[model samples]
Target: MSLLASEDLAEGTHNVKQGLPDLLRNTHDVTSQWMEENTTKEETELNDWANLPHVVLENVFEQLNEVSLLRAQFVCKRWYDVIRHSASLWRDKSFRFSGRDPRDLTHGPYKYASSFTRTFGRYLERVEFKLFSPVTSSVCKKFQKCVKICLNSLIKTKAHLKDFSMPALQLDRSQWMLYREDMCSALARFFCKSQHTFERVDFPGTRANFDDGYKILYALGYNTGRTVTHLDITDMMISRRPMFDIPQFVECFKHFRCLQELELNYSYISEDLLEVLAANLQENSLQVLSTSVTQHDPHNQVIWGHSWAALANRCRDLKVEFYFQRVMTYEQHFRILLPQIPLSEASFDGCYFADRDWQIRPTIASILPRFQSTLERLIIELPDTREVFETELLSLLSLCPHLWYFKMSAYTSTRFLDKLLEAVSEKRCNLSVIKVRIYVRDYDTDHEEIDLERIYTKYRDLITNDLIDYYATCCVSM
Candidate 1:
């Protein structure tokens, strides 16, 4: 009788478990039915996005890029109204050329990008105009007109512009001359108005006369010298023809007291200019200076050791990059410059040493003691077939306690891999990254051969065997 009772209890429990799903389904159905019937009005009220606070809508619009913003305006009358009134939506806007002819400003995305500034220029803090496609003379003129319009709007609104990028105008010497004066005047006006707030100015591919360039620089010196930190005047065509008297050009740098990074290309550097720079660099504020020597300049003077020493004394943490053509020799320059400058990073490219007897190993070894603590990055590119063994290079590495990055392109023997591993192990160098391009000759075949795979394998072994705690890459050049 007790076994039967236990079976009955089990049957009852099974029946209740089977009915549990039905009970839950009924409850859910009732609740959902009630919600459907009663909450329609509340749902409609909650769906009113237009009723959201203005600030919230502004934030949503800010996330949309320029193209999306144009489409977003057509959503409804209320959204259109929100977008029109929200001036902050246009702040920090960038206008990029989308491979369209600048003259066709009435059509395509350029129309919108160019015209938006007319309406919302007051709210702009940072404006960048990048011309990715090349422009014809007519298109450049039209582009200049648009820039002038934007500058006028900024001036009218009294907007404190922070960053400005001159379009990468790929104009020939003649085309540059056509619009140079007008652009310089407009830029000077803009700089005069926004000097206090300007931080970066990039002129990637633009040309001007020396007078126009001087006017622009004078405006920068008088107005934005202290405020502007990063200035790039690369590939600037000062004239249709070359002007060897770059001393006047160097005079403009005296006013850039607060500059952190300066880049100039296709310019002449003379001893007088170096002396001026040494005297005028505003309290050791300059950090990075990159310039290329004008090739075949009759007026090019040898940079004396004292001039470099004076500049180096003021700018202790300066990183110098000297780009030279085959016309100049680097050994004499480095001999004078390296010992004076407490450089953190240095790069020498396309430089040929006049003194055939001068070896890089000795020059580097001489400066290792002076630069050990400060030097972190070193790049040397010389294709000379001189063999540099591990033993000679290891001494230089041992002195550079803070060295983190090294790149060299030169000729070396098979023992270079073994020697590098040995140096990293023995000296305990702080090299975290290294890239080498070594040219090796197949002596038996009397031809150049580069076994990249073997070098990579050896580098991998160095890391795997705990010989170096860094990233290493090796390339072979034949």
Candidate 2:
């Protein structure tokens, strides 16, 4: 029955979703009547509203959402006292800081609730930083303050810290030298207190140089690593003067007894750790190992003959992802990316690294032969607007028979993309999505990024010669 006309709902509201909305429409009047009728003369005479059975008020409060439930506290002094004193009321209610600025936590919409958070935070499931870009060096100190504040409020009422995703902290060289160690210590305390029964652990954009993000990670690996199902540190970078080296990660990744999905960058994982990684895989766990092809110790180490077969034998679902950051020398790519390992995804960040000395880049022709059948997705990115692929990508479409998603991004040149549109029409390939990135000088103007989807998608034929010609003429100004 509809809410407006239903007598049954008004009398006996069964579901919380159905009852809460109508009840919220008249909070003062309904709650006043509840206080009046639900209490006895002896209890009501002395202003003893606390004597109104706990279960009766709890049933009503439990049906309400966070905002309504919080509002319910002001009905009486007893109501305020009950909510403030009781732990279970706020236990499962999440404390979320989805704002971009530190001021948002201090002075914005959450300003009113800051006191509430401070009062009964430990019972909260977890503190979450949501829907914000990684903070820069300038505001890293302020952001870290917000993080510490949020964590500090959570007084450990129970040893039931389920899952945790550390907030993004992208500090510059100067910020790292000054603020990183103190912030690390703060996070270390949080982990030490509530490090039990975690099922998912994620620390994105972690810089693993020195003792930067190491102490926090070591604390985690020390406790909940054996139980976490998904462990993601893919975007972590450790170039030089590393602290959490190969052997530490070997011991760390070893503790994941029930790990189903792991995302690790090459800097954290080495050739020596691959065997350990292989052995740790549960029956269905798939490892997405990342590599930046360079003349580094582990990047240049051979994996084809030794641990590659062992990984394939143990885990059929093993998928390796390549990130061609800066300079991708052929020596490292060929050495590790062997026939036995299933090469699922390949990404080109740039054609060359910062180092000026020119090294031989392995062509797609040479590097992809072994796992062409296994290849599912190929992404090519050119940081320089003028830069295009060293090798033509038109032939790459045919090389990988099982390729699903092909993306050419971060470049202004649409010439290769035009050729791809022309070729894919005639000779059918297995490509499901073709994503191309085009650049316009001004960031604000509305423009559609060219996405040539599956054969059946109506928009596939939309990218005609006429459209490409139109794009070429007006792309620069757009």
| Index of the highest-TM-score prediction | 1
TM-scores of the candidates in the order shown = 0.71, 0.63
Backbone clashes in model 2, listed as residue pairs? 122-155, 326-352, 326-353, 327-353
What are the per-residue Cα lDDT tens digits for candidate 1 across 167-219? 56654445445876787788788777763777777876665666776677778
* Superposed Cα deviation of residue 66, candidate 2 (Å): 6.7
| TM-score computed on alpha carbons, candidate 2 | 0.63
Give, for candidate 1, the lowest lDDT window spanning 10 residues. 442-451
Show where candidate 1 strays beyond 4 Å: 1-48, 51-62, 76-89, 98-110, 132-135, 167-172, 237-251, 265-282, 294-299, 315-317, 323-338, 351-373, 381-394, 409-414, 437-478
Candidate 2 has its poorest 10 consecutive residues by lDDT at: 465-474
The residue ranges of model 2 lying beyond 4 angstroms of the native Cα positions read 1-126, 129-155, 171-179, 234-246, 290-305, 328-332, 351-362, 383-392, 410-427, 438-474
lDDT of 2 at 433: 66
Measured over all alpha carbons after superposition, the RMSD of each candidate to the real structure, in angstroms, is 12.3, 15.5
